[model samples]
Target: MIKILKYTEYLYLAVAIASIYKIITLWGVAQQETYIFIFFAVISIAMFLFRRNYRRKFEKRKQDNQN
Candidate 1:
C-alpha cells in the first residue's frame, strides 16, 4: 500500500509536468485552449500534496509505533 501511494505521488508529478509542457507548447501555437491543462495541473498538484501529507503521517505513525 505504501509503495502504491508512492507510485501515485510520482504519477501526479508526471501529470503536472505533462500539463506544463502542454501549456508551453500551446502558448507557442496560440491555437489551443489551455484551461483543461491548467485544471489537470491543479488537480495533480493537489493530489501530490495530499499524498505527501498522508505519507508523512504514516511515517510518523510508524516511528511512534517503533518508539
Candidate 2:
C-alpha cells in the first residue's frame, strides 16, 4: 500500500511533465488549449507536492506507532 502511494506521487509528477510539454508544443498554435494545459500542469504539480507531504506524514506516524 505504501509502495502504491509512492508510485502514485510519481505519476502526478509525470503528468505535470507531460502537461508542460503539451503547453510548450501548443503555445502558439492554440492559445486556449495551451492555457488548459498550463492549468493542468500547475494542478498536477500541486497534487504531487500535497501527496508527497501527506505520505511522509503518514509514514512518520506509522513509524511512531511501531516504536
Candidate 3:
C-alpha cells in the first residue's frame, strides 16, 4: 500500500503530460474545451509535485522513526 502510494506520483505525472498533449491537439479544434483541459492539467501538475514532496517528507520521517 505504501509502495502503491509512492508510485501514484508517476501516474499523476503521466496524466498531466497526456493532458498537455491533448490540449495541444485541440488548439484549433476546440478553443472553449481547451480551457477546461488546461485547468485540469495545471491542477494535475500541482498535485503531482505536491504529492512527491509530501511522500519524500513522509519517507524521511518514517526512516527517522525506524532508526
**Best-performing candidate as measured by lDDT:** 2
lDDT of 3 at 63: 92
* Cα TM-score of candidate 2: 0.98
* Tens-digit lDDT string for candidate 3 (1-67): 5588778988888888998998999989999988988988999899999988998898889999999
The lDDT per prediction is 0.88, 0.97, 0.89
**Which candidate, 2 or 3, would have the higher TM-score against the true structure?**
2
* Candidate 1 lDDT tens digits, 1-67: 7889889998999999999899878875664467778888999999999998999899889899999
Residue 3's C-alpha lDDT in candidate 1?
Answer: 88
The candidate maximizing TM-score is 2
Residue 43 in model 1: shift from native, Å?
A: 1.2
Ranking according to lDDT, highest score first? 2, 3, 1
The TM-score-based order of candidates, best leading, equals: 2, 3, 1
- The reply for model 3, stretches above 4 Å from the true place, is none
lDDT: the better of candidates 1 and 2: 2
